[model samples]
Target: MRVMELVRFGGADTAFATRELPQPVPGPGQVLVRVMATSVNPLDLQTRRGDYRDQVALPAVIGNDVSGVVVETGRGADDFQPGDEVWYLAPVFAGLGTYAEFHVVDQALVARKPARLSHVEAAGLALVGVTVWEALVERAGVRAGERVLVHGGAGGVGSAAIQIARALGAEVVTTARARDHGFVTGLGAGTAIDFSAGDYAPQVRAMGGVDVVLDTVGGDTLTRSPEILADRGRVVSIVDISEPQNLLAAWGVNATYHFVFVSPGRAKLEALGRLVDRGELRPVIGAVLPLADIAQAHTLLEGGSPTEGRGRPRGKIAIAVHPLDQPPHGTGSSGREE
Candidate 1:
C-alpha cells in the first residue's frame, strides 16, 4: 500500500511524504477497501497545519473522504463482499485514514456508492454531504416552503447544503462571490448574495429574513446572524467559534444555534445516496489530482500557488488514488484495478 503520510505538522510543502506500507487486514466487523479516490477537506488542511496536533500523531495518514471498491471483508462483516463499490467518511483521527491505496473501516461506516455518481464524485461528496445532512436534516429539520440561508455557497459544504435544502422543498439563499452567482444558482440556490459587496444582512432582511441560517464562514457571521433570521429561526455552524460573540441579539429574535463538528456514519451516507439517486443532489468537483500530487491538492485548497490552470477551486479537490481514469461525473466505476 502507498500512502501520503503527514510526517510533520507544518506547511503543505513540507508536511507530507510519500511512503510504502503493508496493506492492512480488516478486523471483525470491518472491511478492507481498495481506495479509488479521496477528497481534500478543510479538516485535512487543519490536520496538515497542526491545528489538531493533540489528536493526530506524527507520521499519520490523515484524510476523511473515500470512495472505493471492497477487496476483502473481515469475519462477520457480511454487509458487503468483495467487488462492491462503496463510499464513506473515515472517523476523524481514526487509526488509519483514506490517504493510502487501501484502507480498513468498520462496515457500519460504509455505504453503497450512489449509482449516479462516479468514484471521484462520491469521494468529493462523502464528508461534505454528511456534514450538511447533519446540519440541515437532523439538526435544523429544514422543512418545505421555508427559506434557508447558506453561507459560503461555493464551498464544498455550502454547495451540498444548497442542493439538500432545495431537495427538502425549501427555498435556498446562499452567500458567495460575484463570480459564483451562476454556479450557486445552478445548484438550486434561489438567491446568491456577494458578502463582500456590502452588508448582506440588510439585503437578506429586505426579503424577509430566512427561517434557517447555516454558518460555514465564522468570524462575525454568528453574532450578526440574528439580524437576518426570522422569528425562532435556527442557526447551524460547522466552523469552530474561536472568540466570544454577543448572543443577546439572538435572544430577542428567539434564535436557536447548533454548532456541528460532523461525526460520520453510514446512515447519513445512505440518506445522501437517496437524494443523489433521485438526482436532487450532485457533487461539484473543482479539480482532480493524482495521489502523488497530494501536496499540490492541499495547496490549492488552502488558496496557495499553482492552481494547475484553474483560477480557484470552486468545489472539492479530489485525489485519484487508483487512477480509474473516470470523469468527474461519470455514471460509475469502469472496473477494478487488480
Candidate 2:
C-alpha cells in the first residue's frame, strides 16, 4: 500500500514522506475500504507541525476525511457489503488516517456516500459537513427562525454552516472578504459582511442581533461575538483560541458557549448524506490533487506563499487517491508524477 505520511513534525515540506507499507486488515465491526479520495483539513497542517504531538506518533498517516469503496468487511460488519461506496470522517488521533490507498475503519463510522455526489465531492464534505452539523444542530440545537451569524463564510466549515443554518430555517449572515460576498450569498447567507472592512459587530447588531454565532474563524471574532449576540444567545466555536478575551459581556446576557471538537459518527454523516442527496447541501471543493502532492495541498490551504500562486483554498482540498475516469475539481495534483 502507498501511504503519504508525516515522517516527523517538521512542517509540510520537511515532514511528508511517501513509502510502501503493509495493508491493514479489518477487525470485528470494521470494513476495509479501497480509498478513492480524501480531503485536507486545517488540522492536517497542524498535525504535521506537531501541534498534537502527543496524539500523533512520528511517521503517522494523518488525514481525517475520506470517500471510498468497500472492498471487504469484518465479522459483524454486515451494514455495508463489498463494492458499496461510502464516505466518513476518520476518528481524530486514531493513529490510522485516510492518507493512503486503503483504510480499515469501524463500520459504525461509515455511511453510504450521497448518490448524487462523486467520490471527490463526498470526500470534500465529510469532515467539514460533520463539524458544522454537530456544532449547529447537535450541540447548539439551532432552531428555525433564529438569526445566525457564521464567521469565515467562505471557509470549508463556514460554507457548510451557512447552508445548514439556512436549512434549519434560520436567517443567516456571514463574514467574508469583498470578493466572496456573492459567493457566500449564493451559499444561503442573507447578508455577507466584509470582515476586512471594519468591525462586523455593528452591522450584525443592526439586524437585531443574532441568536446563534458560529465561529469558524478564530482570534478576535470570539472576543467580539458578544457585541452581536442577542440576550441569552449561544456561541459555538470550532477554532481554538489561545489569547485572552473578555467574556464578561457574556455574563451580562447569561450567554452560553460551546467549543466543538468534532466526533465522527455514522448518524451525522447519514444526515449530511440525506441533505446532499436532497440537493439542500453541496460540497465546496477548492482544489483536487493527487495523493502524492500532499505538501502543495497544505500550502494552498495556508495561503502561505504568494509567489507559488497559493491563496486560501475556496473549500476543502480534495486528494484523489485513485484515478478517476472524470477529473476532479480544482486541478490539485492531477496529471503529476507521484
Candidate 3:
C-alpha cells in the first residue's frame, strides 16, 4: 500500500513524504477499505504542523475523511461486506488515516456512502457533514422557521452548514466575502452578508436576529456572535481559539454555547446520507488533486480563495486516492476544524 506520511512538521513541501507500506488487515469489528477518495481539512493542517503533537505522533498518516469500498471484514464486522461502498472519518492522531491507498476503520464508525454521490463527493462531505450534524442537529437543535447564521459560508463546513440548516427547516443567513455571495446563496442562504464590507450585525438584527450562530471562523466572530443572536440563541463554534472571549452580552440573554469537535460515528453519517439521498443536501466539491499531488493539495487548501476575476471555490478540496479521472471540479480548508 502507498501512504503519505507527515514525516516533519513545518512547511507543506517538507511536511509529508510518500512511502510504500505493508497492507493492513482489519481487526475485530473493523473493515479494510480500498480508499477511492479522500479530502483535506484544517485538522490535517494542524496535525501536520505539530499543533496536535500530544495527539499525533511525528511521521504519521494524517488525513481524516475517506470514501472507499470495503475489501474485507474482520470478525464481527457483519454490517458490511466486500464491494460495499463506504465513507468514514479516519480517527486522527491514530496510525490509520485516509491519505493511504488502504484504510481500516471500525464498523461502528462506517456508513454506507450516499447513493446519489460520487466517491469524490462522499469523501468531501464526510468530516464536514459530521461536524455540521453535530453542531446544528445534535447540539443546537436548529428547527424549522428559525434563523441560523453560518460564518465562513464559502468554506467546507460553512457551505455544508448553510445547506444543512436549510434542510433542517431553518432560514439560513450566512457570512461570506463579496466574491462568494452568489455561491453561498445558491446553497440556500436567504441572506448573504459580506462581513468585510460593513456592519453585518445590524443587518442580521433587522431580520429578527438568529436562533443559532454556527461559527466556522473564530476570533472576533465568536466574540461578537451574541450581538446577532436572538435571546437564548445558541452559538456553536468548531474553531478553537485560545484568546478569551467575553460572554457578558450572552449572559444577559441567557444564550447557550457549544464547542464541537466532531467524532467518528455511523449514526450521524447515516442522517447526512438520508438527506443526500433525498436530494435535500449535496456535497460541494471545490477542488480535486491526485494522491501524488497531496503536497500541492495542502498548499491549495491553505491559500486564500482566488480573488479578482478568478473564481471562488464552492466546496471541499479532495484527493483521488485511486485514479483521478476528474480534476478539482470546484468541489472542495485549514488546521483547527473548519
Candidate 4:
C-alpha cells in the first residue's frame, strides 16, 4: 500500500516522504478498509510542527478522518461486510493513521457513511463532525431557541458547528472575516461579526449575549469569552490551551467550561448521519487534492484563509487516497467552494 509518512518534524516541505508499505491485516473485531478519502485539520498542522512529538514516533502516518470501503473483516467483526461504505475518526496518536491506501480500525468506531454524501464529503466531515457533535450536542447541551456563538465560523469545525447549532433550533452568531460573512451566513449563522475589525465581544454582548460559546481559536478566547456569555452560559473549547487564563469573570455568572479532545465512536457518526439524511447537515469541502499532494495540502492549511491570498479554502481540504468521482449534485451547502 502507498503511504505518506512524516519522516521528520519540521516544515511541510521537509517533513513528509512517500513510501510503500505492506497492507495491514485487521485483528479480531476490526475491519480492513481501502481508504477512499481523508482530510486535514488543525491537529495535523500541530502534529507536523512537532507539537505532540512526545506522543508520536518519527516516520508516522498521521491523520484521523477517513471515508472508505471495507476490504476485509476480522474474526467476530459482524457489524460490516466486505464492500460496505464506512467513515470514522481514527484513534488519536494510536497506531498508523489514515494517510494510507489501507487502514484497519475496530468495528466499534466505524459507521455507515451517509448515503447522500460523497467519499470526499464523508471524509471531510468525520473528525470535525464528531468534534462538533461532542462539543455542542453532548458537552454544551445546546437547545432550541438558544443563541450560540461560534468562533472561526469559516473553518472546518466552526462551519460544522454553525449548521449543527441551527439544526438543533439554536440561533447562530459567528465570527469570520468580512469576505467570509456570506459564506458563514449561508451555513445558517444569523449574525456574522468580523473579529479583526475590533473587539467583537462588545458587539456580541449588545445582542443580549449567547447561551453557548464554541471556541475553535485558542489565544485569549477563554479570557474574553465570559464578556459575551449569558447567565449560566456554557463555553466549550476544542483548541488546546497553551497559556493560563483567568476565569474570575466566569464565577459571577456560573459559567460552565468544557475542553473537548474528541474520541471516536460509531454512535456519534450515526447521529451526524441522521442529520445528513434529514437534509439538515452537509459537508463543506473547500478543495480536493490527490494523495500525492499531501504536502501542498498541509502548506495550504498552515497558510491563512482564501481572502488572505494563502488560498486556504473556506471549509475542509480533502485528500483523495483513491480516485474519486464527483460528488452527487446538490449534496453540499451553499457555503462550500471548491
**Cα lDDT of model 4 by residue, 1-338, tens digit:** 88999999989888888988889999999999988899999999999999999999998999999998888999999999997989999999999998898899999999999889988999999999999999999999999999999999999999999999999999999999999999999999999999889989888989999999999998998888889998999999999998999999998888999999999999999999999999999999999888888988998887744555776788999998876454312223121212
* Candidate 2 to truth, TM: 0.95
**lDDT score at residue 262, model 2, on the 0-100 scale:** 94
TM-score of each: 0.95, 0.95, 0.93, 0.94
Model 2 misplacement above 4 A: 325-338
Tens digits of per-residue lDDT for model 2, 1-338: 88898898865778899988888899999999988899989888888888888888787898989898888899999999997889999999896899998899999999998888988999999999999999999888999999999999999998899989998999999999999999999999999999899988888888899999998878877777788888889999998778988888888877889999999999999999888877889999988999989988887887745886668877678999887753322224232221
The residue-by-residue lDDT of candidate 3 on 1-338, one tens digit each, is 88888899888889889888888999999999888899999888877777888887777888989898888899999999997989998775667788888889899999998878888999999999999999999999999999999989999999999999999999999999998999999999999999899989999989889999999988887778888888889999999787988888888777999999888899999999999988888999988888888887887777743553334356788988877544222212011110
Each prediction's RMSD to truth: 3.4, 3.9, 5.6, 5.1
Reference-based lDDT, each prediction:
0.91, 0.87, 0.86, 0.91
1 or 3, greater by TM-score: 1
**Residue pairs in candidate 2 whose N, alpha carbon or C atoms collide under 3 angstroms:** 288-332, 289-332, 289-333, 290-333
Per-candidate count of clashing residue pairs (backbone under 3 Å):
0, 4, 12, 0
Q: Which stretches of candidate 4 lie over 4 Å from their true place?
A: 304-310, 325-338
Candidate 1 ranges with C-alpha deviation above 4 Å: 304-310, 325-338
Runs in model 3 lying further than 4 Å from the true structure: 304-312, 324-338
- C-alpha RMSD between model 2 and the true structure: 3.9
lDDT for 121 in candidate 1 is: 94
lDDT value, residue 334 of candidate 2:
39
